[model samples]
Target chain A: MRLNGNRSFSSFSFLALASLLALFLFFVTLLLSVFLYVGPRELASSLLSEEILFSIRLSLITATMATAACLLVAVPAAYALSRFNFRGKGLVDVLLYLPIGMPPVALGAALLIFFGTPMGGIFSARFVFEVPGIILAQFAVISALATKIMKSTFDGIDPEYESVARTLGCSRFQAFYKVALPLAKGGLITAVAISWIRALGEFGATVMLAGATRMKTETLPVAIFLNLETADVVKMSAAVLILAGVGLTALILIHKLGKRWPAV
Target chain B: MIRVENLSMRLGNFALTDVNLRVQRGEHSIILGPIGSGKTTLLKCIAGIYRPDSGRIEMDGEDVTELPPERRNIGYVPQDYRLFPHLTVSENISFGLRVRRSGNLEDRTRAMLDLVGLSDLSRQCIKCLSEGQKQLVALARALAIQPKVLLLDEPFTRLDSTAKVRLRRELRRIHEQTGVTIIHVTHDFEGSLNSRNRVAIMNDGRLVQDLSEIKKYLDEKLGYIPIDLRAGG
Candidate 1:
């Protein structure tokens, strides 16, 4: 029986290791296949093209703006959800989860409909089918995810620290900024990186709300769609590589910082 | 001075019902109870961390029932010390002063470090300190605000035997030196019985005995005579 148990344990470990390696190889091969369609010189020229350059710049600016707006709203919302018990708290929690549960295209369609309404029509001139629409869509989709991450971070911290700070003469806001915010540094970084990455790669919503215009509203994902439409696989592959490279660098940076801080 | 009048609170399955007690100015008092006897809950209520469903808490003739914890002018040292993990020893001690923007921040922080005898470890990180050192930091941090009353919830629960004895001595010395009213909560009977401080015993969320001398309460309530009292007799 002991020999049988040892054999079963080894089989389980083998199965898990094999599954991990299989998934690793699958992604590595999928990413490497993009290089087969374009040579180095073509890839460099495609990347330096005016339209692609504009797409890259637009994606960076919109993703940064969306991430900043998301944090401004998410930090306080998550703190309230983590710390307080109020009327309609359950309803508020469900509403915050709505965007995460909905498909990106459906969320985009909803935003399109809202823009047609009289209330949303007020801002339609500034946002609908414009560059700012990309940022608004990304913020809508990633804010829920950012809030969830921040809420988990706050939940891991003990409420006693705030209580002790209160007794130490810190007002509620002071305690939050001085003690709670500093302790949440690792989670804040995680939220910002994940949300920014998600915003950069946003496609279905960006195309739906921002209309995939050539240079005016074209982000990187929109650029990929346009290139694919014209069957320009070389430019498409270059754009894919650029997006993948940026996301990989961000993930690596987050990993390095996570090791250094190691989260409280 | 602290007075709790008809204080009652119910949290989930635990409740503190109609608990009343008083600690006089400059007096050291101990709230002795078993675990889950609402000792910490009572201390939190006194510190304004938890609002009782019904009660009036008066500190030095001021009824501060509706006040928030920050406005209460009380120093609280929770169980586990709760030193801000991100800050160093001196920073933890000076947190109250910094938040209030009190003048002479450096001199005050240094004085607190000296009072706790932790000046040498002032720059040390909170994670590097032993349990005893963390407790002292927590104590110094609390006392730095010069609160009218100090509420300590299970200050010695995590200490080893030697640390417990040493902390008890340190607490007594600090109490004498500052003349600050202190209400310490603990479950250790033998550990709390040594001091001449007033003892308030609690059971099932009620104060069974309030503001009585330690020896008199032990003899009358628990029928346990002290060795010194027997020798005197």
Candidate 2:
């Protein structure tokens, strides 16, 4: 109808048009909020706060670390899941996906309960409530997402590439590192950006497991939440703006890199 | 040498039983069969992609039934060419060399590209390639590793008639030049078995015929089959 045709569009056409319109409205709201609720003047004062600065820096550092860890762990996990046909493979795959479906607060609380009780009695002296706890919480969230995305990417790749590499005298590991990994660079980078952004935006998990201490455990989301309850809407909005900017930048980078992916 | 003795396996909704064969070093053998004849399955077993339940597969007189595919040192060119879509033609050609940590990768890749007449398209992305070009790249990539054995599954299905003739001639030349053992799998028996030293005819998972008695077999058996063997058909 919108394309000026007299006849009604097909279901697929209608579905696509609906999604496009929904996405357009979503971006419109985001832009409006950034301009009206969290304008430049509100951001100026927010940038001066020690708590906000500390939270921002901490979030960036921990999220980056989490991204690295997740990539290292998920690449092999996803590759195995995609390529092999072993016993209980389905069960292992589901377990890897467990944390993704759970609410972040519930996931964090469960981890806290498990790690804080008997498990913590063993290693709590070193892990929970510290910077390690924040990293662990971020890792918990990021790794699950990275594994899911990376698995789909690995699935998209033809297994014959690895098989061919193997015949060429490359060990399985070498084939993965040299051939499969290079081919999957686009999906892997996309996964990294997504996981990084998600880790950077994590709130309930970091807050529940790590605690929102002034400078010790407070993260960007925690700082934003704390500022909001205190009625410091201007500073909160500025932090929100910073979060939105980072997310937008990540999305743009993903799009650009996605376009550059080699077509073998 | 590669030997498959009494290979039998039950695949989902299909089965290959008592499959047996041998390929001497430097021999060029082509497999011919109808659809559902387990030609591809037999190749898969040799390539280590499928494990036969009861078979003794020996490569160079060593039992390789337990070996993983990556350790088999056997090059396989799958149907569809299976070129890595994320790599350029040059990168695809060099993939095997890189995987093997073989020195002189550039020289090997260059020679293979030249051999396959794909040197000019070496920098092009595989997705941009025509069907024949992609097949050429895939062939070159397989040859780059210099494996002792090469297995090609339906190698010319995607090529046009002109390209197919060229590829067949090129395959013969490469087989002679490299002295590497070659096995070709195809359902198009007439098109594939031409001039190959030996032909293995399979049907319903069994070796119905191995036409090594070339002149006699051709006159007696092939003469009766209504398949096209002429060049342009």
Q: Write the per-residue lDDT of candidate 2 for residues B1-233, one digit (tens) a residue.
A: 99999999999978898988998999988887777889889988898888899988999999999888877878889988878776799998898788667889889888998888888888898889998788778778877877768899988887878888988888888787788899888877568655646677777788754334333444465674323333212
Which docking category, incorrect, acceptable, medium or high, applies to candidate 1? high
Candidate that scores best on DockQ: 1
Residue-by-residue lDDT tens digits, candidate 2, A64-159: 998898889988899989998999998999999998998888888987887868756697755578887888888888798999999999898887
Residue B6 lDDT in candidate 2: 94
Mark the regions of model 1 whose C-alpha exceeds 4 Å error after superposition.
Answer: A1-9, B210-233
- List the lowest-lDDT window of 10 residues for candidate 2 chain B: B224-233
Error of 1 at B111 (Å): 1.0
Candidate 2 chain A: minimum summed lDDT over ten consecutive residues — where?
A: A1-10
DockQ measured for candidate 2: 0.61
What's model 1's interface RMSD, roughly to a tenth of an angstrom?
Answer: 0.8
